[model samples]
Target: MWLLIAVSVFVGFLIVLYLASPLITPKPLDLKGVHVLVTGGSSGIGKAIAVEVAQRGANICLLARNKAKLEEAQSEIEKVLVDKNQQKVIHISVDISKDYAAVVQAIQQAEEELGPVVLLVNCAGASVAGSFEDLSLNDFKRMIDINYIGTVHVTRAVIPSMKKNQHGRIVFISSQAGQIGLYGYTAYSGSKFALRGLAEALHMELKPYNVYVTLAFPPDTDTPGFAEEQKSKPEETRLISETAGLFQPSVVASSIIKDVVSGRFFSYAGLDGYMLAAVTCGMSPVTSIMEATQQVACMGIFRIISLFYLDHFDRICRKCKQERSDPSSEKKTS
Candidate 1:
């Protein structure tokens, strides 16, 4: 009984330490005069981020495959410029996924017009949803090409310039699905998961050069692309995903930019994202003292709670399979 009391007191002391230590986060990087490049900047989260950065005095370059859309996005972003006297917003038309040379050329042109890109945001991506068995090889390849390879193409083009300057910020917009693979995301999940691995490796490689890397794991946001993806998503996928609340692009983009500016390696959106990042902290570098303390103290409890979530998802999948196998199974079982 005396030992139990001692243990409880010790645990309480640790909890207090975790709660109180270093609530302050690092100061965010100044955006004034920084040359910022955003891929897939024509719409959705990318467009939102571009608008936010532009409001902060960053020189903005928006890249997408559609000239018309890029023009429209640039117009929107330009309206938010912190100073009307700064250089005009730049827009490029090129498919980053299929043409690495073209992407590189576009970056060169943007740099010439604006300045060397000190901040690069990789947001050009797409998703294809279906069961693993139902998805075609082309489906998998397309997702990988746009979501994974597209990020590579843009990042590679900007790296040399960043390395030359020895200071830069690279942000990759991954998905919550990247952290925890869910049903009907076989191809899409794989592509997003690849982003996490790339970001982690890049974070290690770029840190010494004063370049920071951030991977954003945003939950479902209200975006045009997300709406399109919903059309192809399996019923089970939609059902499972509905549990996590959908967020606005502006909200997500705001959180991402805030984290990126602070030089954080992982940028999570909303409470779901916070929980997911905390549970999956693993070997990822922790920049926030409070975040590190939370992970150290609560990971085990979160894991236990996560098992219930996994079991719920598993049950949903099983039920869906059963219903498909025998349409009358529900009635019969009841």
Candidate 2:
């Protein structure tokens, strides 16, 4: 029994390594001389991806709502430059709510000015945290409008030009909650879940045409948007967020850029997020079930395991505080 268990563990790890290897990498999304567009480039993960791609010598077209913020982001992108010969970036301010056709026009204009947009990042999104009962129809619609429909709008406009050029990369910055739904994330997760389905279907349709699509599952990114959501979240959601340390947008951006350049369909940004995705990818889920009892270590069980590690750091901090305050503990150290 022990030998069988060891064999299974070794096999599982090998399979993971095989799938994660970049040898399967396709054409690079390195935008050298190519143009790229990222919605929500005013700040956060979208902005980070913009910077990273710009550094690679791509001419950029920034998209967002605030004119001042877009200009500011363009300035920041310019500050990183070593010379004028390297490709530069441009800004176009538009609300992605698809509330205005002007947003679509702006994207087209960008493609015309910068050259066919070879990369698109649909990172503009929002989350409304509340009990299912507390959320209204309008709340749900708003989440859908900005998160899902907005994605459709952008992809619809961007792909036609990409098809004409026979090349492009489209990325959707989904969340872990989209994969494993949460108690208070019904609305947010719904939009992200739908986004994943769209990305999958789009990938199959476009692979023949050389256009690549990637859906990134990032867990609880440390963005200003998330900070704002935390201020009014339910206690249960807040506890969950605290356990899942807010991930940096740069981490998300870097991982996504690698996958995009490599023509991979999926990328996971958070440690726990990637682990969960790994388990999902390997549906047989080996070495998890007790061999003798045959008790299945299901998805729910795996999630609880993630929660345990997610809260470990916080628990250690609390333990250290208690130990420092206890006089007996101090004497033991001394």
Query: How well is each residue in 61-85 modelled by candidate 1, as lDDT tens digits?
Result: 9999989999899888888887989
Per-residue lDDT tens digits for candidate 2, residues 1-334, read 9999988986785566456422233566667878889998888888889988877777888888889989999999877654558677898877788665887788878977887888999988888888788888888999999999888888888998888888999999888877766667888889988987898778768766778788888777778888888876765667666666777888888888987887766677665665666545422211221211122235566667767755764565455556757858746867
Q: What is the lDDT of residue 250 in candidate 1?
A: 94
| C-alpha TM-scores of all predictions | 0.91, 0.78
RMSD of each: 3.6, 8.0
Provide the lDDT at 154 for model 2. 81
Stretch of 10 with least lDDT, candidate 2: 284-293
- Candidate 2 Cα lDDT to native: 0.76
User: Would you list the C-alpha lDDT of every candidate in the order shown?
Assistant: 0.89, 0.76
Residue 65, model 1, lDDT = 90
CA lDDT of 186 in candidate 2? 84
